[model samples]
Target: MSEKSKNEPFGDLMKSMNQFFHEKPVKNILQSMDDFFKNPFPNSASFHVELKEKDENYVITAELPGINREQIQLDVINNYVKITVKQLNIFTTEDENQQITKKQQSFQQSTRTVPLPHHINEKKVKATYENGLLTIKVPKEKGKRISLDGNE
Candidate 1:
């Protein structure tokens, strides 16, 4: 028997089996597992951002180390506050010519959006960063409820 004719049937068999094993979901799950094992902490660059209601105000706390004071920004909307930590360039490498052989290395640039549980006075919001921790306080607005009459 010739080699071409002997291998033709096996090639066709592989083509049919390929479709079953190369499905999108199967490929995605395999890739996810591979990434999980390679990098156990995939989101190590992101810091912790927590929000809670306290003392009639909503307090937002974040843990950020080695971050400069100028690298933080806060934006407040109607009921949402977004905290953005700009890229912190911790170090850089240069060559003999001092031409920046390698660009700056930044640990992370992350943003966290938080929705206030209660109506808050955004104008009175205050933020303070100290000891590598950022804290923001948002005062709550007063609320009044009117009695609903039982009328069909």
Candidate 2:
């Protein structure tokens, strides 16, 4: 038999099997599995941001552990706020009594950017870090309206 005909039988079986089950249902099952594995660790070393709005300003707090103040950058462009933090792994060797041991391992550096609820004055922004928590105070733009009318 020719090579083409030799594989025709298997191909036909596969086609029949595919026709047996609806493609959409099968695809949904596979997609659900993919999403489950995509975020294996949902809360591992991930920073959580909390925004509190007051009469005159917004207080933004982020839990950033193992990050130094010098490694963070904050910027406000147009109406969006961006914050980038970088952390470096530090290794140390210590001697206990008379034995010396070396330990080596590092965590991956990650960056996250969040959009603010309203426009903020970048010049008046204040940031402070204490006990692995970063607190930022952004004075809300006084004249700017939080919503725009249909006219413009």
Candidate number with greatest lDDT: 1
Q: Estimate the lDDT of model 1.
A: 0.83
> 72-149, model 2: which lDDT tens digit per residue?
777778666667776667676878774547766666655555566666678888888998888888887766458766
Superposed on all Cα atoms, the candidates' RMSDs to the truth, in angstroms, are: 9.3, 10.3
Question: In model 2, which regions exceed 4 Å deviation?
Answer: 1-45, 90-107, 144-152
Q: What is the lDDT of candidate 2?
A: 0.75
lDDT of 1 by residue, 1-152 (tens): 78986869687678878886689998788889999998888866677899888767888999988887888988987788888888755576789988777676656668888888655566799999999999999988777988888976
* Top candidate by TM-score: 1
Clashing pairs in 2: none
Task: Quantify all predictions' global Cα lDDT against the true fold.
Answer: 0.83, 0.75
Candidate 2 similarity to native, TM-score: 0.53
